[model samples]
Target chain A: MSVTAAKGFTAAGIAAGIKENGNPDLALVVNNGPRRAAAGVFTSNRVKAAPVLWSEQVLASGQVSAVVLNSGGANACTGPKGFQDTHATAEKAAEVLGRGAIEVAVCSTGLIGVLLPMDKLLPGVETAAAQLSEHGGEKAAIAIKTTDTVHKTAVAEGDGWTVGGMAKGAGMLAPGLATMLVVITTDADVDSAVLDEALRAATRVTFDRVDSDGCMSTNDTVLLLASGASGVTPEYGEFADAVKTVCADLARQLIGDAEGASKDIRIEVVGAATEDDAVEVGRSIARNNLLKCALHGEDPNWGRVLSAIGTTSAAFEPDQLNVAINGVWVCKNGGVGEDRDKVDMRYREVHIVADLAAGEATATIWTNDLTADYVHENSAYSS
Target chain B: MSVTAAKGFTAAGIAAGIKENGNPDLALVVNNGPRRAAAGVFTSNRVKAAPVLWSEQVLASGQVSAVVLNSGGANACTGPKGFQDTHATAEKAAEVLGRGAIEVAVCSTGLIGVLLPMDKLLPGVETAAAQLSEHGGEKAAIAIKTTDTVHKTAVAEGDGWTVGGMAKGAGMLAPGLATMLVVITTDADVDSAVLDEALRAATRVTFDRVDSDGCMSTNDTVLLLASGASGVTPEYGEFADAVKTVCADLARQLIGDAEGASKDIRIEVVGAATEDDAVEVGRSIARNNLLKCALHGEDPNWGRVLSAIGTTSAAFEPDQLNVAINGVWVCKNGGVGEDRDKVDMRYREVHIVADLAAGEATATIWTNDLTADYVHENSAYSS
Candidate 1:
């Protein structure tokens, strides 16, 4: 259960007094590898958290040995104190792990504009380091979460290497990206340059395609670390595919845990003139609340589905497109085809397929259905 | 209260069996004009409704005399039959009005995909025409609604002319547009070409900037008709302002009626390098479900506010962006500002201002807070 399965990393999570529930809030992951090579992606938001600022600079070196994250207190808008907390966490990780703080990453989520309790956090880090184990992956994943109800992790065993990772998010998931905190580890032998390239390419189509609530996160971070411990040096193409699979799986789980979500819906847009067009159309429908609500009700409301797709500029004639719900051909050439009741949305998982009638291109976006519980959960969440 | 207050026009609404509610589902608005000029804007949804197809073509001529609209069944995705229904409605309106069907406009809303009750509709037009009156504006507006909780109308008087409009929409509102149906009329003597130019320019900024539930409608239509009865055409500049005011007012009212909505929220993005940037930033925040939910609870969650703004591409230093909740500056230059307690969100309206700190451009978007009722309403809607 260790990230070492993905590449080169040791992970740990401990109580840091960031949450009133006393849930583990501090997590540390180190890339104990052949190279301090890493790639990081931050939130697209203009109002980033303090940790995002520090890590954006740290990742600039493409050399990251460790990532320290905390939940329950976002350490954003806390001014100079927020920046200091990020630096302090990194410095503590560097000191204990025997590495330069410049090689460390920092991430924070939960209530923003709150100062971290350095006394509790520093001691907690020491405990996490002491308790770090090869099987601490699940605990570490749990520590990075906020409103997420369940821990999300995926592992893929390849020819000689493996990819395993964890993510935390719900509600603030959208097409551009989800309000996600992701950490990927691979034991495959890969270069720093290749890691950066592979990580971005995988994410562009994986995590970037999930649109749950249409809101982005300030502390969204996706880190890929290669430990090169497997002695398995696969081609870049093979490694990229494995990474994509892990991401796709974890993203699926994230959507499954989305706030008040009853269905983990997959929107597959195919036959578009271009990949970009397919993705655009898919994402547009993926984030539509009306369509999402229809899915939650098990109504198989194909009309709402069609209207959602019509919102994009994918250059497909409405009459030329075809749609299938849960394997039922509900529409063809823009008209009703099969009985919508033939498809059942009662399960936790639902599938929607759209044929753009343009060219050969496709994209699948993971999403969640809108539910009353979702509204209740979100509305009742106090600041 | 009639559309013909602008002069040279007649209007009517009659039972057409388009609505299961059995209300008057048919409406007609004719323009008796000094100039046969017209302008229209339809939904950006790629999968348009049947009526939208007909109107899109008719609008290309820029000369329209009548608009035939039906409520109850949206004639969307009924395939060829839906298109034919729109054509039939227009032809009937034109034949009775003694003009080519091409000179007639068509609009429809309600359940999508169901066939129109043409058996009763063909003759329904004659009844509607006979009932056309100067005070039928309210009826025409009510005849086009599906889920609207209340009908909305606005009137702005000029020195020599008047602008009156009616709109109906509840949820599915966003910055790109709302799931809206708007009809505007004025007696200002303006040319068709000028009307077209002014209409596009005004709508792109006003009606197109509200994101209610982030769902684009397949039946959104906004038509502006002008009659020269006033014999006083103000400058195009003034006319544009008047039109914008009417639209802005209606947009606000639409927000007020947002499904399960308890508060109307206005998001203002200012100090951007371009108006487009302002809208991009504003719409991003307005579409954030978390922030909207927090606002709903009367909790000034400024943290969610800043993080939402962080998700945009507008040029601005994260530390230089300022956010205010309910007119109280909560985040200063991307961090916490004054006391958030001063911000009151208990009223039926809320204002969130984001200062991009890039340029002078500004944009405003209207939305509704997320509520439990909204969830309850939507979850069981299709069922």
Candidate 2:
């Protein structure tokens, strides 16, 4: 199924004169039905943005009918003015959609500590509502991006159930949703409790595991809305599968668009004594900047990989670990093995498979390369 | 008590034609034989260099007389031949110094995975050993350089005893000892076991606390030599003080020379309820690339600081936290308190003080500003 295949979700994308570039910067998605059962996940950063605070309160009521997101101004660390901007955004969206302000969620991304331009924002909201369409899912995905080069969205349908999601993030990717902004819409007739459960589970194994640079963002958010437009009630297994598929797809897209990222690395850790050990090993490799830089240089420096894994608290001894990069066994039992030239990291996507040689537990983590553009963007960003 | 003032240690630095720029790359420091007790602390990384392995084995015997180090080739990841090269280096140094091979320690720094050119290396060692002098400490400090802009040296004197050291590293700084090569000398009467105790205690609170980047390295080593040439067996308190002071000074110098660093940030976490909590809290801020970049921009973004603290397991409520930047209390009790304009991070140094308002435990971490040069250096380094 495609992004537009999700039921009851009408989306719109519009240029709101909010960004320096004329890229689509305003997006709106609404649940047309009366049902507004929703569950939300916000960034774990304590220094949260005003929209995050407002949406966190809104989610407490277990109801959300609409989500209005704008790029180009993060409305973060702007004090009282930032809070007022999020409120005004929700209120303006509610006025256009004929819904209560409390039922409308709002998100903003881009330059932080800036006030939203209401003169541009209010008119933009009306235009988005008027421009709403069933095929606007991809457009909505494009509108909520900052450094991302492509829009990310995924949908899966089975047993008359559907799940569609769009995500935006390219840098500052690490832990607690990874500075990524995601919006999901579903019509599986699930309650808020199950939606919460499914979203958390999917995120734990998907978005939360994607650590590009190990930098957490303050404005990251993931929202899930179940409009219940589809009459069939899917079992937990099917619904969970649908959620996981969307998450995995969006996760892959995020890695692909990682800033200055010439390589998208999938680190799979297997044969750990426990699932936690597997996760620990995966995370150790994922956040290693030296290894990431080595990957960007397309050098299969397996020794760097093993050095990162050795730092973990996992029970596996270093001598029992085996690492294969790009389908070549570069190291075995803690010693250098075959020719390093057999591994190729030149591809935009690369896979690093590690065997702990212990128990049968396993895990995977996705990350990006270390690049000059990443440093350029970060150092020159605020300036 | 300056570097060259250590007893029985004659040092030299020379341009042995290792780096393309023709900077000094060969260094030597010899114990003039009143005592020869040695202790070493190496990087925890499992992927060690040939020099690291040889030194670890030699350190196991707790007997060493001299250390010969060079810059511009890490002698790492070059396979079995690398190990043989390191052994040959020790044997050569021992032959020239009229000492046993097992009594000579060797350290190499520079690019990883490259074989050391023994052509320049052998003659360079001969020149360094022949020209060693009591006043060559500064030159020796400059010899073992990589990306560092300046040499780092620290010294302390107490009750007729002297402690001195030199170090080099500009990147890959993190917990469990910053990724730099260090050699320390002392004239105190101490056995290998006692020297280990003193060195470990000093590094635990000094070099290990200065975490510029969260990346550990494979070639990090800290070697301590006690010659007892001054005939001074001072009190333990005096010896500990000397070690701590020398280490702290070296830690400061490492921060000052960090790659792409504009401002040196010192994060002090106080009343953290536990030493581990204090260290965790300080490290969270020290390793933050965003926070470091903000420091580069001279933006007193205390919000980022508070959020970093919240990410730790410091056992304090967010509201009980207070943050001060450059002596200005920017955040009080988890909220903005004063005008951030009063805070200035533009100097060569910056200070951030976080009060957990719990117990009296405290920790301080030194780090460098995030800048474009760091990225440029790492990205093109392997190329």
Candidate 3:
């Protein structure tokens, strides 16, 4: 059901000719509610897209009733004209939904440094608004895709309330929200402040830890909208847990569908002196290209893992470190421990445990193996 | 001529049966000098190899009589046994050369986390020492090859003094000395203090800027030995410039011979508010795998460059950035400028210029393109 899994949401997807190949490239979602509360997070990249800039302001007001999103052009690095186009898109969506322009949000994704086809995009917003229905959520999920092999959606049920979301990303997925556009909805009686806190807490551990390629994009955005249709404001912890569950599900889906990947690697860092140190160490191991290629070839190259760890400022002595691959302690005391041939690598999911042996803090990062197909896909993407 | 191009130096290369394929795997360079003053630099990685740990101590005395290098195994991450083996190798070299064990340095390269074959290596040291000759520098260079396609050698002559060096490295090259074993021999009359300052200054701008694959190795070493045989005490400035030229030459060769790479990218960052910022921006651009792949496909995708620049903490506004590819301005004022089609990328060398429009500081970094062949080579390496 995607976003419509929540009680007070309707959505639609439409083909707007924004994509040259005639794929559906536009989507709209409306929240009919007793309360219009929303929160958002965008890419940490300094060079943000125009739509990201526009939606940031809209989200600042802490209220939103409608959202318009499109794929096929990122509208990034297009200067002042791109900002105007994004503003115009929000205005068109607000007019079609019979709401004020300040109550609308906008998002865009695809090739960077290109302008959107506003002539087609503005009219498609009207068509999408007219076709919005509770059953249109899945279609809306499918519209915002570029290089993604499949659409991703997830939902979590609470006591008389629910949380649901949709995500689209396949490449350039790293920290700062994973280079995607995500829209999550909830049908609980929560204000904008609670929504903001829960969303930030959830994404901090979910989307922020999925580092597919260590390349952060310029047009990433994640928004959360709330409606009072359920009339039940659960405890803050319960609401945050639901949001985290949905975000983790969507983040996992993003990794599973990473571009040209054959294996999804879960790098778990253990026994760190601090959470930040664990995360830094995990990200370093996740970004080691040689190690990723070794894993892709089914070779348990723990030395590459140690080399990656050595490059970081994490707290650990080289001789005190240990590593396990698929539950086999291949490296102990920073040296060869078990026979590398004993480690199995025939599964699509690989688990690597790096023991820093510092204190007790831990962190996990999800990434993919480097492959020839990945090089081919990204090499020919912009051409 | 290589290291032996300078006076009072003798070297030899020998096959020790350490490699399963019977390739030359042992080399010895002896400085038969009136003055044996020396200086050395090593990898900044915390998880250093056993030989690096051993040689760092030898360099502390500021006098080195000989250096023994092997190519069959790196002897890294091997615990106490690895350090003992490194000490044993140095002891054998010192015994054969009639010097103290503390005056001998050892260097190893190849697969990490494995022990060298002591039975073959110790006896091979005797054979290499007996065969040492004034004209054996080329053979010494060849014996240190692991995955390198060619032996690297460079020479810089000043007045009556000469500086010459040999290096071997082909992969795992990044900042902190380019993941190679280098031996520089000079006949100029200089003290250890002068050699230390010159070596550090030379490597800071040359070897430290070559980031081939963004993977720093655990066993990078560069040693400079002065024999004082030429009897020409050149100025420190002239000696330093000569050392820098030789290092630059060898660094370029390492980039040219990077494993499975087809294109060499020279990223130059200009108009930075500080030199550190320029270096940070240049390295960020050079290590961008997406941009490297795009360049491999001959696509002048300036957006990826801007995206990389945005990730750094450099002082530059988004709207003030400009990028040039192969002398064509593809991006101006952070937006699209000239036609990307006008940039020619048909050659093996690709130049990228990023203008921060902040100040006049600049830096250059050399890297290699991401290729399917690189993935294939690394994936099947350790098996």
Candidate 4:
């Protein structure tokens, strides 16, 4: 169950002939709800996709009747024509579902700098609307995949309500909301303001902290829709926690499925002067290609970790820093501590802890190791 | 001709046994100067190597009679003992040359977090001092090699004086002086202040703009020594121009010799509102791994270029941006322009021009395309 796991949400996924391989490329999710409260977070990248630009406007009204997504073209950098295509897609979705055009959010993913195939996509939307079902969340997740090898979905339950979501991203994953398309639906009695707050708070610590490849995309977007079908209003904290749980689960899945990734690196930075400091240091460590390569080889190269931290302006003394990899404190007080050979890196998951020794604040950033396969996948991806 | 191409310098390279394979791991450059005025630049990385810390203080005296450089182990993150090793190395060089310890500078590269074998290093310094010759510049350059396929050197002649330098860096190359050990020597009758100004000015545009792998090393150090032996003092502009030329040549060499790189990418960011914006945009484009990988595949993916520029805070309207790969304008006015198939990318050099359409400022950054070989080389480097 993805978005359809929640109440009053119907979804469908279909092949639109947009992808040359004839794979599922179109998805439609409609909120047949008593409440249509919605919120969205978009990529911080200035060069946004046309769909992202259109969806932002749709979300501003605090309600989304439906979401139409397609994976074949990014609809980015195509000038005025790209924006027009996104507008047309929303209009088509609105017409088929009998909702206002302004209440339909459109999301597109795939190659950038290309226009969507409107003929295939518009017809696919009508077919998807006719076939919409309450158990079509998994199909919708698969439809949004670009290079992802598997679909990702998660669900979190409240007292009587439930929150469920789906995500798709395999590369160009680096903060700015983690460079992916995600749709979350809730059956709780909630207002748009609370939904916005919960989504932003959840993503700040979840999606915003994942920096798989340190390459931010132009089409990242996350939408949250509340249906109030359960009619049971949970406390703000409970509702927010549930949203965070689902987002964290989906974020973890994104890291696990990152394109050509070999090892999942979880970098936890502790003792930072502030949360921002921790995040800065964590991102620096996450983005260091040399360190990523060393981790891929299981060398336990803590020197690279220190080097990465040194590049940041975080409040940390060079000699006071400490680092541990795989539970082995390979570097202590900024020098060689435990024997590197003692660290076990045979597992696919690698845990690194960097102690700034500055304050109590901390943050963790998830990333993947640099590998030859990542290079191969990306070098030939667009072609 | 390398460092000793000037009139008052002697250099030598010797196998110090510091490297397990007994490669030439030690180099010594001495200035038999009527004037010992000098200048130096080091990595901005806060986690500096022991030798960098030692050399920073030595250069503070505005005089450097000798420089002792070693490969095989970077004396960084070794705590107080690492600093002690660097001090001892400098003292040994000063003792062998009968000069003040304060007048000696030390540089070390290779693996990080490892202490040098002082027993082998001190003895090797003596041997290098004994073998110092006016024609040993090539050997000195060769001794500094880590993964560099070949040694790099350049020289520029003025009215009568000459500037010559040597550099060694193949990986961990990103700003912070491009992560290398460089020794530039000049015979012009220049003071310490002028040498400092000229060196900084030249490096700001040359070495500082070459971002190969976007990993700044802790041991980056560049020193310029003016011996005043040529007895000819050219205007500062002429001297600075010569220094910039030599640095530019060495910077280009660094990009060409970048580890596992099949193509050298030159990113030119023009039409920026300010020089800082131009440099920021250029560096962002230079450091984009996705764009680099695309370039490695010889794919003229201008969308990746736009994505990189969008991530920067530089003054540029998304719709007003333009990009040219090689000679073809693949993206014009932030949209598709000329046919990407018309672009030629079979050459080793790839030129990318991003026009911001913001102002008149421009900057260029040199980088290398990401390749599978780079991943393989860095992954197993320490192992």
On DockQ, the stronger of 2 and 3 is: 3
A best-first ranking of the candidates according to their TM-score comes to 4, 3, 1, 2
Give the candidate order by descending DockQ.
4, 3, 1, 2
lDDT score, candidate 4, position A82:
93
lDDT of each: 0.81, 0.83, 0.93, 0.93
TM-score of each: 0.94, 0.87, 0.99, 0.99
Q: Candidate 2, residues A18-137: lDDT per residue as tens digits?
A: 987787999998988646789999888776778999999999988998999999888765677678879998999999899999999988887654668888988899999998888888
Residue pairs in candidate 3 whose N, alpha carbon or C atoms collide under 3 angstroms: none
lDDT of 3 at B169: 93
Q: What lDDT score goes with residue B230 in model 1?
A: 83
CAPRI-style grade of the A/B interface in model 1? medium
What tens-digit string does per-residue lDDT give for candidate 4 at A129-193? Answer: 99899999989998999899999999999989999999999888999877799999999989999
Largest DockQ belongs to which candidate?
4
Please provide, for model 1 over A206-245, each residue's C-alpha lDDT reduced to its tens digit, 9 standing for 90 to 100.
8899888777777788888777788888888888999888
> What digit string (tens of lDDT, one per residue) describes model 3 on residues A241-264?
999999999999999999889999
Deviating ranges (above 4 Å) for candidate 1: A4-10, A31-37, A158-162, A175-177, A230-238, B2-4, B32-37, B60-62, B175-177, B231-240
Regions of model 4 farther than 4 Å from truth: none
True contacts kept of 4: 0.80
DockQ of prediction 3:
0.78
- Taken in order, the candidates have interface RMSDs of 1.8, 3.4, 1.1, 1.1
Across B1-383, the per-residue lDDT of candidate 4 in tens digits comes to: 99999999999999999999988999999999999999999999999999999999999989999999999999999999999999999899999999999999999998888888999999999999999999999999999999999999999999899999999999888987787999999999999999999999999999999999889989999999999999999999999999999999999999999999999999999999999999999988988888889999989999999999999999989999999999899999999889999999999999999999999999999999998999899889982
